[model samples]
Target: MITINNEPTAYTPIFLGTTQHSLRLSLEILIMVGMKLNDEIIETYNVSVSAIELGQLPDIGSEIAIDEITGSELSGFKAKLKQSDAKIQNTASTELEKLVDLKNVGRYQLLKGQKNMTQELNVPTLTNDNLILMRQMLGVTQKELSVTMGINEKTIRRIENKEQGISERFVNKLLAVYPELAQIIEVQFDWVSLTFPDLTSKQVIDDVLRLQDNLFLERPTSQNFYTREMAFAGEKNIYIQDFAPFKNPETQAIEQKFGTTLYLTGKGTRLFEKALLEQSMNWRNFFEKARQYRGHLTRLDIAINDKWGLLNMNDLVKAVQEKRFWSKSKSYAVHGN
Candidate 1:
């Protein structure tokens, strides 16, 4: 039961299925069908436990940053996931709790088709940790259990270590010591769901292009003469004004296609790479997208240039001193202005 707006709502009826079955004969039939369905659910469908958990995961909110989330932000994030987890756990717990009531109804409807309680025997398959947990729950030390079972403490430890799978006699001895363990130890697989930030292709492209545009627009330039580097690319030391821009064959030919090259110094490249790496996303996914976006942005920014500044030395200075995209490709060449 849960309270809603100051009203208490009961949750009992939902747990007990609509029609309670009776008779060992009817149960055997139902079990057969249930087993068939379980196989189809697992083998025919690709659905996995992890995927189911992920589907039920609560929204973590975009306010959670890539850098840090502390105090209330962290608390609220965890509370949402835990609330969902509790809902899942309750459904499983309620189903198990209804087992005895269903069994009673079945026996009554069948007119004592199965009468009287019989001892239930199960395999002794408890793990190392589960043995310790049962001992802890009984509030007994290993030494005490050892004496009660008439076994050495070292033997108990070895069995818990999985050196022994436990004999029929050993399980009987354990039940005598802590009988509740028969009902307490249930094996359930726990699934963990992970959440990642939402990032779009447009956002990634914009960020990469913005970095290039800043460098392009503010690049240090040579006014009247070619910088020592630009001349190597194929700049003739002719008068800057004597040629009316396109009068130079090389200038006209190059302008018709692509703009003059923009040289990205090692420094600017380093700064951009660092920022791209720090983005809050999977590193492999980020770099894969970054590499593609960087290529597109490079073409757009450098494909066109002002005639006067066709040869841009480029803005890529980190203060008065000083980078990897180029080094990774190693495509640097000494070219003309």
Candidate 2:
């Protein structure tokens, strides 16, 4: 009989076959045990006396000496039974430890598998999410951003949603405001292309008048006849001459009479090209410097020239004094240039 939860439970039968393949009538012994809680059928068998001499019975089982009436003999039998019970208990404990270890290993493997699955199923990219984050970081409303960028708010919404393709012009406008948006969007710098709108007739006239005012402010006697002619030519969609009346009086008189001159050789044309090239190069240098510095500054302090020959060198010294600039300088010295 076996005890479970302080109650007697039945032991089930275990069959062991012999080479003879026939039941041993002398070995048959009926054994009775208690039923388990689940009402499972139990059977038991008694060990044969002959099988004990052949070492078929386990050494831990109880041994009974027939007709033994001595107290010493009875005490020896009880000690052997206790030793057998201890051996069974130790075996059971060792098996329980192995099962616990296997369970822990299985749980760890399951967790690791779940982690790998999550990494594989991660989202593709964050282009749209980044666009929204950038817009929010700038602290500008969609309508305000549209006004500053000269684009419709609907277009901005579409870009944030990734539902519509972004045009180069719009991209450029965004970059101008938030330069780091390029890195966030994971777009190559050279892929950007911008097309500026042509000036309207009224805008041309206004620009010409503004230039006239500037020249008049600088020199009251100067009529800025060259600027007026260029404005008129621009309005008429005709090419203007490159005559510099201020520098050359003869060319100026001839231009005043002809009302037009070749556009290429004009001082304004040369100045315009030089300014444009300088501005473009400055922007390129600024981006390079920003990259070298790892985006440290909020604004670039590089010098840039305008079409009217206006030079801006407001913060060049401060930029050079920065630690990042010194680091770059050291690297350049160590290298060839």
Candidate 3:
């Protein structure tokens, strides 16, 4: 008798020795175990069968009740038995963790609903449940994800429903395509600075003002030369600076090193949104005009906030120590003890 939920089931499970022969399984039973049998041989099996009925089975060999075996005893039994190289698991979390090296890729951490952190950081795997939640958080539909990921909508639904499993390669591919999905909680572009080489300060100011709907220009102030601060909603401000005098080392002449520069912070993007709408321009249009004016992107900072402690800062420090990252800057400063 098989005991489930402390209740005995009439049917007993039988173990078979195939001896290199192909062993067939009942799809109905496999579905009941929340797993599928592939071509390879299987040694040990542990599953919950509450969802299905075991009607009939072939009498192959002696029956061993899982409840009768200890985990160490099972390990010994499994060691003596012939098993496939591929590891198989029925649960989504177990299967996903088996496929990927989570140590290499950062673990994903998330909270339940909008409350406390109920999940542990160690066993953080990108399960189908996480995928569904992430899509929902991103306010995207299954069809939209399918279109973006180039995966079949039905396939995504199947994975989410636990009818199918996704491979590690596919998981990495998905993350590569939609890097923002890894943010899991919140992602924001905090700082943006652009330099226009060809355009004068006046031209840059005029173009910026065209997009300014709620922004207020402050009184011009002098910081070496003339500078202005544009205050927007939420107390965010944009700093505009004209070229400053610099002695060219090669020419030994006083020249303007920096062109007209505009600094837009994360908060300032809020006001910039209104400016874009007022000017009937999207980000692409604005960038296009900047390119037309020979604008150069000087700096951009992406702020990823992990409220649930998903990212390990120690791993980043170790990566920097190992020189695993690449940067355009020659030197970087690491903060924290």
Candidate 4:
């Protein structure tokens, strides 16, 4: 089960830390501490200027006495702020850590949401309840999933009703059709040491279903959405399809990592399939993008083009940072079954 809390009292950190304390010790603090400090100073300056207009001496505070901050001090704040990634990450990480059973991508979302975490994945441990939930989420009936898996609807029903444990064969089939489900249904990180939250009531279910409409089919894009298509000759049908498959290695890696992180589950794959339809993947442009994403998909120890495998945290971050980064589809569906 997922949980979230209310907003924080203030955006600023209540307690001082080693680096912040060090920064405070610098002459920069004489004028302002950070954004919060700058905001306070600016507000006071505005109010003081108003008093001056009426011929009154503004006794703002003691900081104005000895420091008598100049505009130059404020200018230096930008440079310091530029180097604040560590502090920003530390604060966000601290809050996100409260939620367990999250991969980096899930953690990133929780941070993005709370300053919050969210999503589950595909794994053997999934309950039969999760099976029904996911089937319904994709807008597919038990018959669809059954047919897609080369099985019968009765088996799907039995699994959903908790008549059996989710077998490895079933898990493999589900992931093959929806690879991204793995991360969303299971905790794949070391920091995720806590067990699942206990069921609050009989009405409350344990599995996360079509979480946030992952199962909901998307509305087809505008009529003119597909501006390009090529005709193909089949046995009896003339097939014209939009968007070519993106087979470039680097781009695929980047898309896999970025999509895995952003969409947080199968919903991500559905979105990418959309980009393939509307977003331009013009060969020359896509080739360059593939190169850029490849650079970030590897590390000093591993050359990307020479190695193709699962990415780690640093590589995932770089892939998501790509300017041309794509997203999940607003509306999508499963059809192969």
Candidate with best lDDT? 3
Model 1 clash pairs?
A: 22-106, 219-315, 232-335, 232-336, 233-335, 233-336, 234-336, 266-323
lDDT of 2 at 28: 24
Models sorted by lDDT, best on top: 3, 2, 1, 4
- Worst 10-residue lDDT window for candidate 2 reads 103-112
Q: Report model 4's TM-score to 2 decimal places.
A: 0.22
What is the per-residue lDDT of model 2 for residues 184-265, given as tens digits with 9 covering 90 to 100? 2110111111111233222222332122211111111123233433322122111232223334465544322222221222
Each model's lDDT:
0.29, 0.30, 0.47, 0.28
**How far in Å is the alpha carbon of 13 misplaced in model 2?**
96
- Distance from true position, residue 94, model 3, in Å? 40
Q: Rank the candidates by TM-score, best first.
A: 3, 4, 1, 2
C-alpha TM-score for every candidate: 0.20, 0.18, 0.37, 0.22
Candidate with best TM-score: 3
Once superposed on the true structure, which residue ranges of model 3 sit more than 4 Å away at CA?
1-187, 209-236, 243-259, 305-310, 333-337
- Model 2, which residues run further than 4 Å from truth? 1-126, 179-337
lDDT of 3 by residue, 236-279 (tens): 34556665455889999986544567777654443344345445
**On residues 194-224, what C-alpha lDDT tens digit does candidate 1 reach at each position?**
1112322123224432322111112123542
How many clashing pairs per prediction, in order?
A: 8, 4, 1, 17
